[model samples]
Target: MGLFDSFSQIRNILKNIDLAAVHKLSQKVDLNKLMGTVSKMSEEDLAKMLKFMQAGSGDKRPKPEVNGDFYDLSKTLSAEEKAIQLKVREFMETEIKPIANEYWNKAHFPMHIIPLMAKLDICGLTYKGYGCAGKSSLLEGFIAMEMARIDSSISTFFGVHSGLAMGSIYLCGSEEQKQYWLPIMQRMEVIGAFGLTEPEVGSAAAGGLTTTCRKEGDEWVLNGQKKWIGNATFSDITIIWARNPEDNQVKGFIVRKDNPGFKAEKMEDKMALRTVQNALITLTDCRVSEVDRLQNANSFKDTANVLRMTRAGVAWQAVGCGRGAYELALKYTMKRKQFGRPIASFQLVQDLLVTMLGDLTAMQTMVHRLSQLQDGGDITDEHASLAKVFCTLRMRSIVDHARELFGGNGILLEYDIARFVADAEAIYSYEGTKEINSLIVGRAITGESAFV
Candidate 1:
């Protein structure tokens, strides 16, 4: 064969080799000596070498993004609600997004963010009085969704304070109690926690009140343990639900942190929603004045009323989580290239993205109606429970599909889906488990309570 033909054959062979390996090879080879040798070659030989280098280079092209909420649910809200939603989104993206993983990893709550979050003026968003905004329940649900989309732990923190704890007082507290606590709590100057679940009891908190309270002169003595109490560790006050010994009826008390017998210890090493400051609270001879007891909370039925409202918020939170996962996965798929094209363009990948969006949209719509029911004063426990059960179940499925789209990167915290995947577990269990909430609906339809 001719020498020129031999050189062309060699260049064709080198083009199949990896450019990264070739660069490494070039580094070891004396570039001056190599250049001296290659400079003697014809221009055609250099062109072939350049072509080989270009062909051997690995792809570094950008991928497309995958976003859920294709229907633009935000547009369904009023212009005012939409603006507030955007503000919340911006806050989550800017403030919470950066530190979420870190706090989650360490299982620590970011107390400093509480003051800043309160400044957003979103607490008691749906309540009509007691220094509240009196916004629509839809707006409140959307705000919960926005917070949870970025970090469910933070959302839980807010929900416990704004929804469960403060809501309990708003819905059941007397006018005097409202005047005393609502304004400070609205400003987040006094953080609140809800103590409902116990170490041995969770979903059965209703009709299974192990915590006991007794009247002693003008004060109520409380004794029991509460587990998984979010925001309890540093909360200014915790709403402790206990059974009144005299009447055997469930009652609510505003247990201040400095109360001599109120002890709250931080629960450690949680795998999901770790950024929330969960506490295992021990109330031994805790003294709460009769005036601090929620006057309107006559029974466990009243407590369920609070859960009904917060459960709807949980449904919205689930939608936010699914939306976040879908959006992140879709974005990753579009940008991550394989086989010389974006993965998002692949059929199977598109299938997953579409499925996630469908679930997200379903969840969003379901919660929208739920909020409407709440606003119209026709919301039932079954309504909120059904939404909670349905949305959270779908959310788990959506996050799993989203993680699948990320391939190896799906498991990494930096990708964002990992947090959603983890947070979904807590969302699934808290407020009410799938079984508990399902039975709440089951009791409504079948007229039978299956909960043992």
Candidate 2:
């Protein structure tokens, strides 16, 4: 037969068992029983069906594009913003994806990736001047999501540096301080870390900072310990928040790496975000020069302002983590076979997958608008707090569902969902725990603060 005749002959056979027919049969047959029957089919029948299935797919398999953005929220961004978003996505997939699990498993920071990441020029994305791109808050949120999609540890590391540490200065530092540090930090030449949560104080950091800062003639003597400070072990500069002994007001200082009495011990055996170099920082009469004091950070209110801004980005990171896990689970289900059928062909499995996608979509849409409010300058403490609470809650649910879909492989780090499952816990508790953030929104909208 001629090539065209053979092709036409195959097409005729393909039409007999196309995806549409298979989908209909799947609905009529009990998935478990149907799989058993397919497994028992004769070799000739199995081969013919497999060939028909492939041929029926033609050039387009009609596979649903694996996406967590159910409502297409990225459509709201402008073309330029979308381009930047895609650029960051490509960077994460190309640079971070391969090394993410390895570094995360070893609990080691990949130092070499820093300069490559810096070349992307995404740090201080929303800030204007100081060689920044001056993009909107939405773009920043997208970048956070992109990073977390591949590796949440890298996202958290970047967030601690660019959002919290750099933002603290951008929002509160004096003009000279801004001119001095913003440019270097923006270029990622000088990495940063925020030291706010102390060993004794976690969620209560606003009201209780055990770390004390006493002023001397030319420097501030800092004494106290900071716990779970991301990137602290090797960050070039750490923003240490401590209560002033004289005034009882919280203050911030740029604690340089070479401070004589400063020590940062790597926090080991973290179940989540292992790639992040979280440190239990110790300061024994660590004297930071007066020039290093954040001139405008007068109180805990200043610290809260920085947290308020970064909390929204954390919400977006949760979305990314959830979305990444969901995509992995969905793709696995579509390919993983049991008996003779893909596990995704089962109704119950599809239900779980759809549920995960729903949660992922909700989280994405919520953060999308949250960033919009921030860019509009209409964002309040409650606006960000609410997003943090909602998105993290949904993220927890999505990760759970995705993990369940993976069966035993879900717990295996090689599957990737295991990392998301563990990392989601840290994201849920960090910045502000769900309870703390909920009270913030409660105080704003209801005029009653339940927090004691």
Candidate 3:
């Protein structure tokens, strides 16, 4: 071979080598000696090597981002609101994305992020007074979407604390209770959890109230097992709902974790949202002071008020999960080569992307109006229920399509789509099952209860 041909062969081989591995090799080997050897190469060979290195090195096409807000819903926010939305997005991307898979794999919560998360000052985003931002419901919905976009488990954790638990106090607590809890919980100085679903009950929570509470003197005695209480295992306080056996009315109590009778055993082997520390709580003779009771929560009607508010947030979360999966799949298909070109160029693949985007856009628009209804004081139980029902069902379909696009990698946790897919099932089941939410809407539209 000619002198130049030999150098060209060496340069071709080097061009295909992984730069990351080459950099690591240079670190361990004598770098000076390596450069010394390279110095002897001809100017022509050197130029070829440098050119090939530049072509194959780390610079890549700008990564396709995972955003499902196709209609520019974010543009509707004011400048200040958009900045805050971006701030939360940046936090989730930088802090949570790196460790999310590790924590989810181990089924452990990263309590260390609490301080960092609290700094966002988003815990009580929608309420007025007591250190809250008093933001619009649309902004709150956007915040929920941003959290679930990166990790649904984290979103669930936030919603349980901010929406359900703190919301119980906001809507149902007395002035004294609100003054004491809202400020700290809003700051996330004290994490909270909602304890409503029970071991014997899941969907029929409103009427089935199996957990019982009885008043004795100044304290109320609570006895019941609450299952799937997200964040309950470590939350400082959990809002437990139990039926007043005397009146057959449901009431809410703030059960502190330190209380002797409030026992929380971490549930094990969950397939989805593993990073969320859900617990099977045994409130055996749990003693709660009347002062801790939610003074305004008169019955199941009151609990529904809280659910009616938070269910809209859950629908927003479903949009986030679907966005994560759809973005992953879109990026994957665009990069994955088959038949000598990117699969995303294929018609069928484009069809799938279109389908996923259609569903996502529909969800985004629905929740946007749902928030408007809430902000306008026109939101009803059935309105929230319908949004939850439609969004979650569509989210399941979107995730399934995204996972199918992955072929084998869809089930692998490393790809992140698997996490979204697994978490979608939990989102589908929780807050309220599709059947129940659908029945709620059915009753509203038909003026007939189909629940029985």
Give Cα-based local distance difference scores for all models: 0.87, 0.90, 0.91
Which residue pairs clash in candidate 3? none
Q: Which candidate wins on lDDT?
A: 3
What does candidate 3's lDDT look like per residue over 71-171, in tens digits? 89899999999999999999999999999999999999999999999999888899999899999999999999999999999999999999999999999
Per-model TM against the reference: 0.85, 0.88, 0.86
User: Where does candidate 1 stray beyond 4 Å?
Assistant: 1-67
lDDT per residue as tens, model 2, 22-73? 6887799786796577667766676676566566555435788888777888
**Residue-pair clash count for candidate 1:** 8
lDDT of 1 by residue, 1-452 (tens): 44566556556656766799779988899856985787587767766765565555542334433445576777888888888988998999999999989989888888788778877899999987878999999999989988888899988889999999999999899999999899899999999999988888786677787899999999999999999899998999999999987888999999999999999999988889888888999999999999999999989988988988898999999988888888888878878999998897799998888888888888888998898898999999899999999999999999999889898988999888898999999898888889888998999999987877
Poorest 10 consecutive residues of model 3 by lDDT? 57-66
Between candidates 2 and 3, the TM-score winner = 2
Regions of candidate 2 where Cα sits further than 4 Å from its true position: 1-61
Tell me which residue pairs clash in candidate 2.
none
Which stretch of 10 consecutive residues in model 2 shows the poorest summed lDDT? Answer: 1-10
